[model samples]
Target: MDKHLIDDIKHVSLSLFNKNFFGVYHGSISARVSASGFIINSKDTILDEVTEESLVRLDCQKRDYRWSMANADVHIHEHIYET
Candidate 1:
């Protein structure tokens, strides 16, 4: 993830946490990197305190992740990849 974007996520996470919009470890953030790829915050890391290195790279076609797997809708990513 880009440094600025990661910083933004941290700020947003802190805001959301302060507002009680999501529990400490109940929420996550994701951003599209390309049609077939994206970077998602790690599964166990608290969003508010997540760092750039804590981000995980996911490839829709390969169903692979650098850190951990997520149960998100694979079809959505596939559709984007196809498009």
Candidate 2:
């Protein structure tokens, strides 16, 4: 929901993709957006072109329908943030 955060994530995603640090579909990026949650790229997103809609905002403590588009590794991310 934060444009600045979204742009920051986009920049990193592109940089990693350009540097070969990320393959066609091999990497994902996330950052804490709030004390209780974080934002991450949805599954199937092109790392270099992730738009706001391709991002999922998740609560560190719970899952919801909005989680459908999140990567399968989302649970791991959530757990990391929770702790």
Candidate 3:
């Protein structure tokens, strides 16, 4: 992903946290990286404390766990990518 886009995601995440839109353990954020993949927040990640480690890359077609940890709602994210 582009450095600027990753920075934007981080910026928006912090904004959401500040507004209480996403609590420490309650929300997920994602961005489409390709036609078949995206980068999403990990399960239990605190939106207010997101780091590069907090993001997990997933491939919609392969359904592979590119990262060691992933969100429970990964399938939903994948479904969105599929369409």
Candidate 4:
């Protein structure tokens, strides 16, 4: 994982948190990490307080038990990143 990428996400999370957006909804935040892979917040992550463990890296649409920690919105993020 890239340190700068994680920092960028954390920065955005704080900015968005003040807007009462993500902080209120507790929604997932994501960033594309590769052509077919992206990192997103885990299902229960607090956006404003994201840590490395709070992020989940997904490279495929297929889900396994390992993906249980991924966000429920992972598919939505994947679709957006696809294009």
Clashes of each: 0, 0, 0, 0
Per-model TM values vs. the true structure: 0.71, 0.89, 0.85, 0.86
- Leading candidate by lDDT: 2
For model 1, residues 1-83, the per-residue Cα lDDT tens digits are 67887787788878888888757667766667777677666666675687776667777666544534542433444455453
The TM-score obtained by model 4 is 0.86
Candidate 1 runs further than 4 Å off: 65-83
RMSD of each: 3.2, 1.2, 1.7, 1.8
Off by over 4 Å in 4: none
Ranking the candidates on TM-score from highest down gives 2, 4, 3, 1
Candidate 2, RMSD to the unseen true structure: 1.2
Q: State model 4's lDDT.
A: 0.82
Report the poorest 10 consecutive residues by lDDT, candidate 2: 74-83
What lDDT tens digits, residue by residue, belong to model 3 across residues 1-39? 577777888999999999999988887788899888899
lDDT of 4 by residue, 35-78 (tens): 87888999888777888888988876556664788888877887
Cα TM-score of candidate 3: 0.85
| Pick by lDDT: 1 or 3, better one | 3
Which pairs in model 3 have colliding backbones? none
lDDT (0-100) at residue 6 of candidate 3? 75
